[model samples]
Target: MQRPATTPLSDTAQATGITVTNLTKTFNTDSGLVTAVDNVSLHVPEGSFFTIVGPSGCGKTTILRMLAGLETPTSGTINVSTGSDKPVTNSMVFQGDSLFPWMNVWDNAAYGLKMRNAAKATIREQVGHYLNKTGLTKFAKAYPHQLSGGMRQRVSIARAFANDPDVFYMDEPFSALDEQNKTILQEELLRTWEESRKTVVFITHSVDEAVILGDEVMIMTARPGRVKKVIEVPFERPRSVLELRRQPEYGEIVYDIWASLKDEVVGAAL
Candidate 1:
């Protein structure tokens, strides 16, 4: 199968990461002006998994939407460049299941390719590959309504992976699953990421999940969020989420995140 090349990675993109500078977003609700994100800056290394952890309603998702070009930043810049004119393809996996109810799993996974006018052979090959990776091959004929929450989420992941986006924006993609299902999906995600080395920006409330998946974890403040700090995950790659929990460094890092997170959690409540 021919590798689809929507956006060729230039020398700059391969070396540089995503840069968000002084990014801010505001919304006017019936209650008046509300600032969701304030001066949130991030530098996510290219091909690295970056996770953002913060309290609920802390504008974590807002930041991701902005990066994905779904939301406009009120005052700031997002430079996802390699200092070149080359383009890059990106896709988003939302918090809730974003499957097409009218389409079966196979079609939903292949939808992006179809939109791109990719060859049928390419769509079949790519969709088949990701479905098998996510353990959805057996249920390829199943509709989203016929599947469980975890199964639907798997279809979503498969869809995103099949699209072969250069940059992936994920907002709590695994938050809906049970422990067993979440663990399985996490491992599957890591394996796929290791193979493709695509840049990923994942948003999760679980500090454990953030640490387990991220090469660097960005902690955000309470409401009108800003960057609290970015902590590098010291563990080597090919990480086992189950085993990493037992490691001393993993424990310390998880503790450190909570130590910073607790105050924000409390402050948000007040």
Candidate 2:
């Protein structure tokens, strides 16, 4: 994740990911300086999917928010590799509904492209491709209110991919879904990602999810969050999420991560 300083996307167009050094965030609460993240340094390689798992309030969302430019770090530097000069345009999908209520499926999916003033033809190609990939082609004119929870998330996924950002920040995007829908969406996400291989930083509470989707899983300590460990998931993709879960090794990895995370979770509650 940290070979060199970030060059312009023009220089390294396909390169994506982040190099965070001593990243810290503190909130000036009435109680005092509440440090959320503390001197956390880690690398997320371009084209790799890295997932972070930590106890509640362990700064998982804070890190994602920082990467998405929604929050400012108290200290340290985050170098995000944009595939282009448009770093401001990087895509993010959140745990809740982030879609525009007024926009139909097609429009919502194409919203990013439209905002960037992409050519109509290019918009059509990208939106159509992603919508179809997400099984939303039949619902092109459907509004957010017309969709189910899973369907709405699919639209969010479609929109994120249609935008084709250099890096993607996803914070528990499927966390609200039932197991069945979550499973389906995870598979869909993997299929699309298999094709694009875009850099993604995902945060989840589920150990299984972190292992299933991430090439490397980062375990974070409780508040004043720091990297506890970065464990490699050696399973090769394009993966079958359910089938992969059935693997003996899969159970072992999930159990191992849980073993490490359980301690932090306890500490957080204390």
Task: Return the top candidate by TM-score.
Answer: 1
lDDT of 2 at 216: 98
List, residue by residue over 1-270, the lDDT tens digit for candidate 2: 222345564554343568888988899999998999999988998889999999989989998998788888888887876554443346999889999999999999999999989999999999999999999999999999999999999999999999998888999999999999998999999999999898899999999889999999999999889999999999998899988988999999999999999999999898
Query: Which TM-score value belongs to model 2?
Result: 0.92
Tens-digit lDDT track of model 1 for 1-270? 111222245443443668887988899999999999998878887888999999999999999998888887888877775434556678899899799999999999998888999998899999999999888899999999999998899888888889987789999999988999898889889988888888999999999999999999999999989899999998888888788888999989999999999999999999
Alpha-carbon shift of residue 46 in model 1 (angstroms) = 0.6
Estimate the lDDT of model 1: 0.88
| Model 1 regions lying over 4 Å from their true place | 1-15, 82-84
Clash-forming residue pairs, model 1: none
- Alpha carbon lDDT of each predicted model: 0.88, 0.89
User: In model 1, what lDDT does residue 181 have?
Assistant: 89
* Candidate 2 colliding pairs, count: 0
